[model samples]
Target: NSSDAFLLYRVNEAIRKSGAVVEFVREHIILENMVSIFGNTEKQAELINILFLPIVWGFFHIIKAFFSTPLSALSDKIGRKVTIIFGWTIYTSVYVSFALIVFLPSHIQIPVTFVLFTIYALFYAFTEGTEKALVADMVPEEKRGTAFGMYNLATGVSTLPASIIFGFLYTYFEQQFPGYGGTFAFGFGGSIALLSMILFSFLVKAKNR
Candidate 1:
């Protein structure tokens, strides 16, 4: 029961930090394109390449590495459903922000992007390993092997198609719809995340440790 909804949601967000990957890639592609077209400054590119990108990524990993264990510990203390929902909440917000950042002035986008990047990293800390922990939490010790196999299967098979569709929506739809592409892509993602969280709250009977 719990694992059923959990399985479905994991299919969509099986790769929890995927939002981060999409975020940065969009920044490099769409944001940079906008900057050049608007003629913000050539130095901006050099600055990003030389300094900003690395710091953003470095900070992300640093935060994830630092907090992942603690957050997972928290999951043990609190409950998997609650914390998993919390992580999905983080994902939805970040995706929405990434989608909406296009509306901000070019000057502020970099710093704003950096902040979102840091925040996005937290989703991983909250959900990544905890998700596996959840499979263990939900099933009998004897059944855990099958549960984990199914879990891994959901993750692996769903990832490729999900990635393809999201990228298509982010790039192709944007090209087709102009300013609305990201709104559609990321907004849709946020909606899915929100829906999943809500559904999980209702369906998952997985007892927490």
Candidate 2:
């Protein structure tokens, strides 16, 4: 069909938008990296001061291994909806906490900041482990390959615009609200929550399924 091409294009656009929103959030975080915000020497000194980089690497791999088993097993039992809700809830809470940390007085101890960041990682684990499973639940096994391919295409295509938008927002917010990265995090998390709600409403399973 001549119109099949047009429909695919529209589908691609929708996929792009969804991915762009996520990428926009990511780019904001990356752009706000302390190294970029400060400078190389400053970033190096800060990392050394905290011994952060190596510790972070070790910590994440450990956490990933620890969480992967339970999350995967839980998804099999409780179903994807519950797991996704838990994941998003955890994700939102972490972002809220992160945002609060930004607004917290600058004099707060480094350890306190580290704790907040760790909470963020904990939620990320839930999201990462469960999201693919949730997608599988929604798509038929026969179409899983196509669905995943489309999802990947959407992610890749949308990332460009997402990065651009996030860069714009991050710069604007930094100038306007200096030292308030947490507020941005809160906003992003809220947007995700809204999207989640909308998805719940619209993306229902078939009656037979």
Candidate 3:
């Protein structure tokens, strides 16, 4: 198979169980809730669609370059620990914002969701680049391959049950509760992220580079 086809196949396999959950969340949960939030359904969806299209179609190299240059420079100056801690700080903040938006009443402005998403993208840009650099600093050259392989494996293995559980919750609450599926996802993701940060903060000792 061609590289593109292979990547697509792998992505499909990895996300197989979660696909239904995502669709249900997007269509049934998020969209329905959004419609209630914004009385003008067409305008709200159109704005969201517009925002997502750029994220979907934008060039990876452009984004990678945007993130990489500053991070590469930062690593040289302040060291990896500071960079990682800073990245994690931004990452934690993004999840906290997501939880707030999801759990908050639907009476807020529709544009506010887009603002939160933009903030998420900014945090991802910083964390994504710094994370790899931090990994490279921690793992020796010979072990780098193994480190990345384990990372990929963990991501692949976790998705199946994650999707299934999310799917079940989405359907369950969406049926029983009119607009609570997102709240559940946000809370779940945020709580785990916060707990992870706390655990890692205590457990991980950063080396001086």
Candidate 4:
């Protein structure tokens, strides 16, 4: 029951982190492109940072807080498996959108980037707490401590290599493909996340059977 949930949590964390590294790289690439397009003057860069830092961050956090409880309730009603699958679907779709955004004209990229990042924050609300509850549901009262510890350990370990591998892949792709390298790298990472979701679905199904 919850065992598969725990396993999926670990796998999802690993892949999510890996994909996130690529996303980070993409952000830097985007930032650089923006600087080049808009000029490298300090005042211009400061204005750009101002637009993102407080406004985008605050907007996303507000939206996430507003939706978190509703999503948690929905998960309680529909089941953790479905909720997690939904979150992963959104997560994968966000990355896919990021990949596609690379093809759009530079003028439209900034606004689209902010929208996608906000959606990613919203999707996180769906899975963040619900998965922990799923772990608790699957374990015995006395054993939950151990179960949670192990879950944390698995996810923690997964994070270490995820960034490293993603960084290497990002560098390789950027070198090989020039403008589209970051897109390819991010798409690759997103595909890995999608594969993890598929595996998680299968694990959940097998557990249910």
Per-prediction CA RMSD (Å)? 9.3, 12.8, 10.4, 9.6
Model 2 lDDT vs. the true structure?
A: 0.51
Best by TM-score: 1
- Any residue pairs clashing in model 3, and if so which? none
Question: What TM-score would candidate 4 get against the native?
Answer: 0.72
| Local accuracy of candidate 1 as per-residue lDDT tens digits, 84-142 | 98998998898777667666655455567667767777888999888999999888899
Q: Tens digit of lDDT per residue, candidate 4, span 1-209?
A: 11112222222233232343223334687765655555455555444544444555567678889888888778777888888889988878876676566566554545665677578776778988777777877788899999999988887788767766666665687699765555665677679889988998887541221
**C-alpha TM-scores of all predictions:** 0.73, 0.62, 0.60, 0.72
- Candidate 2 lDDT, 1-209, residue by residue in tens: 01112212222232232342223323565533534445564453443333443454466467766776687567677766665567666655654554454334333423444464465456556656666666666787998888888867876787676545544554577688875432563466457665765586468542222
Tens digits of per-residue lDDT, candidate 3, 63-121, equal 54566667656755776656656655655665555444544433342344445445444
Write down the lDDT that model 1 would get.
0.67
**lDDT (Cα) of model 4:** 0.63
Error of 2 at 22 (Å): 33
**Model 4: residues with Cα > 4 Å off, grouped in runs:** 1-43, 46-54, 205-209
Query: What is candidate 1's TM-score against the reference?
Result: 0.73
Q: Give the alpha-carbon lDDT of every model.
A: 0.67, 0.51, 0.52, 0.63
Candidate 3 deviant stretches above 4 angstroms: 1-65, 100-110
